[model samples]
Target: MLEPEMVAFVERTKSLYPSDRAVSTVVEQRAMYERLAAAFTPPLPDGVRTHDAPFTSPDGHTFMLRLYAPFERERSSGTVLYFHGGGFVVGSLASHDLITARIAADTGLCVIAVDYRLAPEHPAPAAHDDCLAVTRAALDGRLPFGPLPASLQLAGDSAGATLAASVAMRLRDEGVKGVRGLALVYPMLGVEPQSPARETEADAPMLTLADVRRYSALYWGDQAGNEADGADSGMRASVSARVAWTIPLEASRYDGLPPTLAIGVEHDPLRDDARLFAERIRAAGGQAHAPVGKGLVHGSWRALATSPGVQWMHGEVCRFLSDRAAE
Candidate 1:
């Protein structure tokens, strides 16, 4: 079934495209992202409206956010802070259009996808800090949407997944509460890339070791407050790369953090990363699990319009959010 699905999936993806791609080197990685982005033109559902608006990051680079909302539906379960997964360098809200809308529609939630600065450009703390700033401001004092539920959720795929954890982690560190849940879709949580998922799916068709290396190479260093200098990142030969850019959830205790949902793909390289993080979240005295797409591949949710895995994931994420909202 997976093989047949992949065959059909590739056959159908002959024309989709993404709007942005991370590019540490405009000559290589960036160009690769552009091609992938150009091939990701997913069609969103009928009531979903996409918009670009300015957001202020703590560092003042004029951050932006992309929102996916059901224009006619005034009702929402809650607002979701989304981050796109592109190995932290490529991937914009556009890359995950189908997934984002499916999330909003299925969960009955409004999704605000943070256009956080990517790696090799706005690396390390910049992306992390921007996400933190947006989340904190979004949920401050007054009700976020004119007296609606002020609760929020952190949602991201791949690189965005890392930021999701980083954002929640920072918030937890800062004593900020009220997050309903954290949903990481095949997240890239490790800086060293030694997860079994990478070894197991070393040659998975949809994603590969090359993709990982490229993504890592793109996100290989810390670009803290250096986007304007035209600086290129330099990889460190250190013992604590994890401390700089990785989300070591395995070491964190979920004291006041919200419940978490870690999604993985059987045929993707980041599967193990998701599994490991989820287990740690549970160990930390919070709830976490890979809601039922274990047989699928990375970014399966992006194919929600075409695959059973994605559709099932859509429903599962909503149920998770709603169930947690009740808790």
Candidate 2:
């Protein structure tokens, strides 16, 4: 059964977004997403300090990075590199300002939000490379994050989570150390459009299978239908396999990864993506915990202040980050 609040939330979204509306171009879809984000994103809490900096990707592309720090903290609990979700196409640091602020304040952690390039213009390696570059910079203590963090972690929501997972894989392969953990919220891990949750939540309120396919097409580029013959697509598979990080679930290795926490929403098609990821991590001898928000829908991070269940879930994430950072 759907929660009454979620049902009403869907209705309100429909009134503004109109399910019948059609978006043919990436520009249109991006505009629609920006509108929704602006309308629904909650206000950032008070006592959180924010600033922006410029980061140049290893590929020489420069982008803006936003940092959120808890107010008046004598020392931070830790630092986290946060990637925002928009199917790798639409989100910005501004769209997720509330989430980062709350995380910084709640966990007493310094959160750095990356404004990576979007797809259908830049595509797969574009987003992935940008995130990996930022992570590398952070790990090397070159990102101007004040002082070296006591511990560092990677985090993201949806597509951002995918980036974090992939980056973690690369870090593991490179023998990089000091990454405390990863926190993935409703991540989009692979091209499994026929997953069970996809079948059951075909028309989930906030996100749908069609929406997933659209985002996949945008992010994965021409590999949208090359799943069966990964060899025929040559570059897509080769680049994605250079390191097990590209498609984390299909990675050749999952051992030696830092602790992980994956959170999923019950009505989301990607719910099992989180479940299976955690299961695999544990199978590979890494600590992992996945919690599902029953009676919730995708994109509920926007409801952090409005929904009691989401608030509790956010608290759980804070607690997890705090515990792992302390360890």
Candidate 3:
């Protein structure tokens, strides 16, 4: 059952980008997604400012990073590296501006949003690689901006949340330090046909199960081998191999990861992903907070202005950042 506000949010969103529309080209999809993003984006919070800078990965691919900071914040408050969600295909830094700005303003922490390369042009591991590079640079104080504070947290939504989780795991494997927390909002951590939400919410508004499969195919491309469609054992093995980084749930272990906040929307097919992830982390003796946004749907973070559930979720995220970053 949808809350009244969430229902309105979904209706307004579909008006801009119809969920039942036939398949379209990537460019067309992006155009529609941008319009949807723009319609929901609120004015930037007072005293929060943003600027963009170019970041070149070790492999020589250049992308942009948008930094949001409060006008009178202490550097000791730490930083958050944010990634935007568009299923690895349709989102940009500009598209997530309002969310990032609000995080910066509310948390009093600088937020850096990565503009990683999209898929179908730079598929699997490309976006992962770019995010990893940015994290590394931030840890080393090598970003164009001034030195990062001692506290650092990695955060993202949807596909971007997948990248953030992957990067956090990779850093743990590398014995790297400085990351203080992990925050994910409606993350698509993995695809399991029998997952509860996948079954009950297959046709979930805003992001359907079909949409999940299609975007994943585009992101994994041919590199996913026979499991590209996620029906074969070959895909599982691939996930165990190079593809694991792009799919955090595929990682063999969940121990030693930072304290985490994984927010799941009740109406999203990906809802169980967040819950399962937190359970695994806790099972491995790590601290994790999994909160389900009742009556909310995927991409509802953009509905902060209209949805009370979104407002509550945003406050939870801000508290997580403030507490964990200070730890």
lDDT of 2 by residue, 17-104 (tens): 6564336576776677778777876667777888898999777899999989877644787889999998888889888887888899
138-162, model 1: which lDDT tens digit per residue? 7773322333345678888877888
CA shift of 261, model 3, Å: 0.5
Q: Rate the local accuracy (lDDT) of all candidates.
A: 0.66, 0.82, 0.88
- Superposition TM-score, candidate 2 onto the true structure: 0.92
Please give, for residues 1-327, the per-residue lDDT of candidate 3 as tens digits. Answer: 987999988888889997754378889989898988998888889989888899998889899999998876565488999999999999999899989999998888999999999988888888999999999999988898766575889999999999999999999999998789999999989744228999999998998888898888888855554444545776567554776667788788999999999999999899999999999999999999999999999999988998899999999999999999777
Error of 3 at 73 (Å): 4.4
The lDDT leader among the candidates is: 3
Ranking by TM-score: 3, 2, 1
